[model samples]
Target: MIRNKKEYKQYLKRDRLALEIYNDGIINKLKNLFFPNPIWTFQKRMRKLEYYTNCKNYGLYKLYIYYLKYRYRKISIKLNFSIPINVFGPGLSIVHYGTIVINFTSRVGANCRMHACVNIGASGGEVQGPQLGDNVYIAPGAKIYGNISIPNNTAIGANAVVNKSFSEENTIIAGIPAKVIGKVDIKKIIKYV
Candidate 1:
């Protein structure tokens, strides 16, 4: 949880990176306020409020958190993402927001992009669910489950159901119980961080 102003700043940095926007400095951060993505904005606000509520004991912050929760809940309902804030790493981008759901126990790495109607969850036997890697992209209507480990810089095609893990990286996976259908150009999709 974010503890204070410093942690809040760090959280904002992560949020900006997750959104794939320029956040090199305060100027860029301020400029982003004018041109915000609705879905990301909703998620960002919710996460900040959640951190504040947990990190502080002051009455004012608690009240503020309560107010933000009310507003964030409305947007979350409209967007249809029932995600837990702590599950995702920095650079979690929700490209489209309709019907996206993630299990609370699942772990998503940095710079992961998810399209609409994607589900990453558990499949009965495993309570831990899927563990996704950094810079992964999940297309719309994709269902990823079980105790699987998806490698870095991979793309899961639309409507694909992934039940097992892939050991390799930079691959494009598709179909029912997804397999490596193609290869992704790693240089084109990611920057060395």
Candidate 2:
């Protein structure tokens, strides 16, 4: 979550790096203007919403906050994402624009790279959702729920169902009920982080 201008700019820089958008020159700006990336636009709007929400809610700022919220919601719906504000830390990489649902209660650490069709929510009517550590990689179609804590530098395989916590770090978890399959160097997986 962006509380101030510094944090907001840092988050935007990290997000851009995670999305592999290096250059911000005139040519790049023209390209983006001509062919807009919905994912990038959505992330920008989400960051702005977070920043403004943390600010003093009065006068024109309040109205602008409402407008940002509306635009964020619209973009989220168009991209099939149900992510809430402040759920993810800096350097969040959404690999693809697909059905990605994250519970509002869930908290993900910095540099989380997630693929399409990923669901991170609470199970059994619980208010708490999964808390993932930094540099975590969630593959496509992975379902992670409940009050679970996934350690740092962990990678979840595709279509894996994770309901329990894993204590070990730098490992890959896969299959139904999700078990540690092999060790992984998270630096290799998440390049920008």
Candidate 3:
């Protein structure tokens, strides 16, 4: 998160790429997507900008965030991520960007990888959004919501609707109102990352 000057500078670099993607034509974006660079990708920059916005300390950060808000709106027309900045930790990896809507109230841990069409929203007023732990991998079209506490190293399968919490760490949760399906090797999933 932008705790100091160095991190803030990094955030700016990422934001600059994001702006380039937005202002530049579709061909450039497609080229970057095909020949992907970790620093130049949309997901990386978005997450980095989100990290900066979460830190409410510096005026410069706030001003940059304000500029990002405008670009974010433009970008959201093609790729939607309405998640609040403070909700997610660092190392948030988005596999693909299309119709992904994460509620602002949701809290996701570090190094979480999410695919396309994933929704993490509120179930009710009393219950807030889901709280996901570290090294969580959410597959495509997963709809996870409510006051669920997903433990570390958990994997939510594709098209799964996780309404209930799975407390077991290093487990795979799938199906509607999701339950523990099986165990997973957390180390294997995170080793390359």
Best by lDDT: 2
Candidate 1 minimal-lDDT segment of 10 residues: 184-193
lDDT per model, in order? 0.79, 0.93, 0.71
List clashing residue pairs in candidate 3. none
Error of 2 at 135 (Å): 0.2
Tens digit of per-residue lDDT, candidate 1, span 15-51: 6666667756888778777776777677677668757
How does residue 31 of candidate 3 score in lDDT?
A: 75
- Residue ranges of candidate 2 with Cα displaced over 4 Å: none
Q: What is the lDDT of candidate 3?
A: 0.71
Query: Which regions in candidate 1 have their CA more than 4 angstroms from the true location?
Result: 1-7, 17-36, 57-65, 190-193
Error of 3 at 131 (Å): 0.5
TM-scores of the models, in the order given: 0.79, 0.96, 0.74
**Which is the leading candidate under TM-score?**
2
Q: Local error of candidate 2 at 45, Å?
A: 0.5
Superposed Cα deviation of residue 190, candidate 3 (Å): 4.3
Off by over 4 Å in 3: 6-41, 44-48, 51-64, 190-193
